[model samples]
Target chain A: MAGVKALVALSFSGAIGLTFLMLGCALEDYGVYWPLFVLLFHAISPLPHFIAKRVTYDSDAASSACRELAYFFTTGIVVSAFGFPVILARVAVIKWGACGLVLAGNAVIFLTIQGFFLVFGRGDDFSWEQW
Target chain B: MAGFLDNFRWPECECIDWSERRNAVASVVAGILFFTGWWIMIDAAVVYPKPEQLNHTFHTCGVFSTLAFFMINAVSNAQVRGDSYETGCLGRTGARVWLFIGFMLMFGSLIASMWILFGAYVTQNTDVYPGLAVFFQNALIFFSTLIYKFGRTEELWT
Candidate 1:
């Protein structure tokens, strides 16, 4: 029962975050959807972690270079996601209000994705998805 | 504030491996370094030049040196581990030689940037940011590359 509630809440929060992103683009005065480019960032954010998980299983080794490289790339991707909206606003391609909205959405969406990974990647019997 | 911070204790984090954190940080630093170099050069391209400003040659050459640094560091440390090998021409010793040439280029670029920085600003008495960009770009890329190369060594040891 609790798991079902958590799933619903997560999905609802995700929807709200996406709504904010769409609102930033579709609002009448700030109708320029160039800020939507951050969606590509959102799509790519989990990719490094996914690739790194495949590169190495949790062995006894203290360090894995491939996993470290993926983590490094993921950090850069996260930085770029935050930087993109600010850059767009700085260059006057997007309004300050829209930039703020998009950044807020990015944070929320990223957090949700992290939560998804945490819940799913937790190595236990109650897997988040059916195998 | 202490109590508030304590409320967010992350004890579970101790279970995770953090040995590679330095390498990861160095890699990100390299990424930032590369980004900054590209940005500075782009800034030079976009910004208007002053009367006595140094032209595009500084940027054009600086990027090549940075490229050399990148290639040098991209090589596996294991490939250049030892100075002796009974094998073919391009064995460990050959890798070392290649590493040597890469370092020379990297340092040469740094020295050249320093010269350009001094020449453009100190000698000519110019104040424009574009004129100064190439020097800073080269310096940043050099430092970042050093951090990356050394970080790779740490990975190899571990």
Candidate 2:
């Protein structure tokens, strides 16, 4: 439960952070900078979570399942955050080819997440046994 | 006070669990926001005077859809109580569908704007009415596929 909460918080915050960063760049007429910042922020945001997951696991405060859940959250945030900048840059520059790539990338992420949830998240409980 | 209670009341909600209630409310809210944002994008794409105006409208729709996605997920998370992976997964699926729909709408708006831009480039004129008509014809076909796919996916709504 704690792990899921952490994941939700992480994902939502990452989305909000990237949205704000894009808004800032849009206001400044910085075409490419927005995507660059998105890439950077996603790369940075996972470090703390990774460390926290490791620490929690080593200390036995959380189970392996919790750690795995944290990892999923971390990865989801990173992928989704990376998406924003790519989409923004393509739209801003009006590069249809690049936009197509962005669209394909988003489709992959969307499908991967959907697949993961469908396969692994179908059980009634997410206790350590499920992991 | 009377109106508030009346608005909150649902004829079939007497035995609904809290989680189900939350999910139902969140779904409706998400759908409403998504549709409203899409409508604005369509209007802006078809009628906006400038490319930048179209961009602004599309961006606004993106922003709103992003917020709606988060809200729906948050409510789903709360409803699942972190125990039922099945419920959580279903909720995520719902969110994904909404995200896809949002993307498609944004894409439609982008295409419309591009059609206008293309017309301007070719003729050095801002008469985009014909271009918009053509764009809409194609857009309807694309949107129909999306709606069809969404309907076929039953995990979330079921």
Candidate 3:
């Protein structure tokens, strides 16, 4: 029941995040959809982590090069996602208001992703690794 | 030259031991810096698309800096120190030479960006954002590579 409730909450947050992303793009005043490219970032952010997990051993060392490289790429992807809208706004390609909306959406969506990882990444019966 | 510089250097201290998270933190910081550099350059490109406004040739600085980034990180500290790497033709000397070339490229690009900023934009009294972007891009990438190279400890964990 607790897991079910958590899933429900996570889904609601994800929906809210998507709603904000859509509003930033589809709103009448903004009408620009370049902010949607952040979705590509969101889709690929977990890829490095997955690849690193598969490549590196679960060692007692503080960190491995593979994991650190993965973290570096993940951070790059995340910052690029935030920077994209700001650059668009700076270049007059998108409105500042739209940029703000997209930034907010990015925050929410990234948080939801993090939450999903935290909740599902446990190495237990209900672990996401099973998938 | 090395002996002269060693005379003025401060003795190394072992007082501060970094936490286990230092590697991850350093990588994240380096990544952020690297991404910011490219993003700033991209903003300039978008804002001023014409060759007259911002010369397309200036982007070579960034391209070289990125190449330097890869070159610098390709050899690990152990490999450079000849601890773990032994089979290569030049061995540790090869790693050191590679690192030296990488550093030279990084510094050369940075200086070139500065020259472009001053010669093309500042002296001409034209718009400076594009020039500033180029300089900042190379500078940030240089620092990012430095951090990624020296900010973490490479230990053989038993």
Candidate 4:
């Protein structure tokens, strides 16, 4: 019962995140879809970790240069995602309201992503081929 | 392989294992550097006067620095620390030479940034905000790369 509750909660949060992202881009006051570029960022942010996890099997040690490099890349991507909207706002390409909305969405989305990782990470190994 | 993992060094301590904390801080620093780069680059891109040539110069130099930063950290600490451990095509001195080249590229980026700051931003009597941003961004990248080098966990060759 609790497991189902958790899944439901996670799904709800994910929906909220997507709603925030869409609203930022589609709101009549903001009226700019450029903030949607951050969706690309969402796709990319987790990729380095996935690749690093795949390539390096030793779960005990996190000190591998290859793994660290992957972490570095991931951090870079995350940081860029945060900054992109501000730049758009600064340039007048997107309104300040849209930028703030996108930032909020970014926070929510990233949190959801991390939460999903923590919740499902264990089972992922068993279902590796499915992924 | 075992010997390579042995080369991952810690800053000799007696009481606490600072590894995790160190890694966390370094990751944050790298993120900060990445933010700095993005902010500066976009600022250059958006500025009204749009000093096109100067913008290109700063960007080219910034790209060089970032590439060098990646090059330096991508090489393993095992290859960097010990002379006897090299088994690659560059011979015993190969690792050392590569490290030197990486450092030189990083420094070259710094110098190029300064050159542009003085030539394009300062002499022209324009606002210093953009030039300063680019310079600090480059510097932050240098520091971020350096920190990333030191932040790693204990590994075993086996």
Candidate 5:
């Protein structure tokens, strides 16, 4: 029941995030789709962790190089996602208001991703590892 | 050799212990620096789209620096020290050579960025923003690579 509730909450938050993203891109005031490129960042942000989890064995060590490298790449992806909208606005490819909306979406989306990982990654019956 | 090197060494700060979070923190810091460097360069590129405004050649420094970052980190510290990675063709010597080449690439890019900054922009009395961007990109990546290499506790696992 708790897992199901978490899933519902996560999905709701994700929907809100995507709504912001779509509004930023599709709104009449900000009629540019460049902010949609951030969707690519959102897609790949958690990939490094997934890869690392598969490649490295569970160990008692403080940290493995594999995990650290994954973390590094994940951080890079997340920062790039945030930087994308700002650069777009700076270059006049998008408006500042659109950038703000996209950034808010980015934060919410990334948090949703984090929440998904936390809620589903714990190796329970609903664990993402099973996928 | 130790005595001579000690002469140049700064007083050690033992306050920072090797906590478990050190690896994650350092890696995240390095990643931020690396991406920030790239994003700054991209900003410069977008702002000054003409090659005459900012030469396309200036980006090579950043590319090489990025290559160096990967090269330097590809070899584990244990591998360089003749430990866990003994099965390679050249073993520890190979790791050391790889590291040396990586360092060379990193420093070479850094110096090249400085040259581009001063020789092309500063000396010519042209706009310095683009050149400064190029320099900062390489510098940030270089520092990021250095921090990634030395900022963590590798021995904690070994």
Candidate 6:
């Protein structure tokens, strides 16, 4: 049941994510920033599932690989969700300062995650060799 | 040997009979209809400028598609839950909330698309009453939700 629920949630979320990407592309002429932000948000939103999968799956090596993937996705999603909206709102409201702050905050989070991964030696398993 | 191993190594899980089949069919149909509706909206938005033409066509298609998808999913979810009324999987408060949110988002997108179409129409045609386009879009969303809530469950149960 949980697996079914997860699959459904992932599919529905993918649809929404696709729509966001399409809309961003369609409206890109208005500004590059909005499209960029939307893309970033979509890129990161699948992190939770990756994390959950890694944490739940058996085998330490597989778990570690999944954890790395999870961290990458989680950071991406959290930063983009928190940052992109504020950037959009800022652009909408014409507040460059707010947008800058949001961008900096996103950068901080991204760097922190990278630093953690590096320090912990959590290597990603997204190599062609695995295939 | 490979075929035998493939068959024998498979894991077993709990299985429901008819309900699982029904759910699978409904999900596929709903997904197709939803994507088709999206394609129609995108096509209309890119080409047509007249609100009346856009409203008439898009609303008809959008409303039908939205209702169809919602009904199918609702029925599928219900079947998955079965007659276990005491457990209330379908009626769970969180599920209901998420369902409502999904409906609202879909409806909201329809309305917004209609509004853009109306704006285009007002720019192109003087004969079309400007307010009518907006009214039609909003009304379609409202009516679709009503039909969805009150419509026969059997229409989607197959």
| iRMSD (1 decimal) for each model | 3.7, 12.5, 1.9, 3.1, 1.1, 15.3
User: Which pairs clash (backbone N, Cα, C closer than 3 Å) in model 5?
Assistant: none
Ranking by DockQ: 5, 3, 4, 1, 6, 2
Candidate 5 segments exceeding 4 Å error: A124-131, B1-18, B85-89, B156-158
Give lDDT tens digits, candidate 5, residues B1-158: 55767668787888877587888899999999999999999999999999998999899999999999999999888888887834767888888999999999999999999999999899998889999999999999998998899987786565
Chain B TM-score in each of the candidates: 0.74, 0.29, 0.86, 0.74, 0.87, 0.35
Candidate 5 residue B22 C-alpha distance from true site, Å: 1.5
Compose the digit string of candidate 5's lDDT tens values, residues A10-106: 9999999999999999999999998999999999999999898888776667778888899999999999999999999999999999999999999
How do the candidates rank by lDDT, highest first?
5, 3, 4, 1, 6, 2
Worst 10 residues of 1 chain A by lDDT: A122-131
Query: What tens digits encode model 3's per-residue C-alpha lDDT throughout A17-79?
Result: 888889989999989998999999999999998898888776567788998899899999999
Candidate 4, residue B145: how far the Cα is off, in Å: 1.0
Tens digits of per-residue lDDT for model 6, B84-136 = 36555445554556566656665665666566456655567754433343444
TM-score, every prediction: 0.70, 0.28, 0.88, 0.83, 0.87, 0.28
List model 4 lDDT by residue over A8-65, tens digit each: 8888987898899898899989889988898899999889888877988876654555
Candidate 6 stretches greater than 4 Å from native: A1-41, A44-131, B1-33, B77-82, B85-158
**Which model, 1 or 6, shows the larger TM-score?**
1
Candidate 6 backbone overlaps, count: 0
Model 2 residue B34 lDDT score? 37
Highest-lDDT candidate: 5
Top candidate by TM-score: 3
Candidate ranking under TM-score, highest first, comes to: 3, 5, 4, 1, 2, 6
Residues A1-131 of candidate 6 have per-residue lDDT tens digits of 54345445545544554544444434434333443454455445555655555566554332232333343345435544554545354435424444444444444444444443343323356522332
* lDDT digits (tens) for residues B27-108 of candidate 1: 7777677556656665565554443465756676577776777578766676777533455767876778888888888888
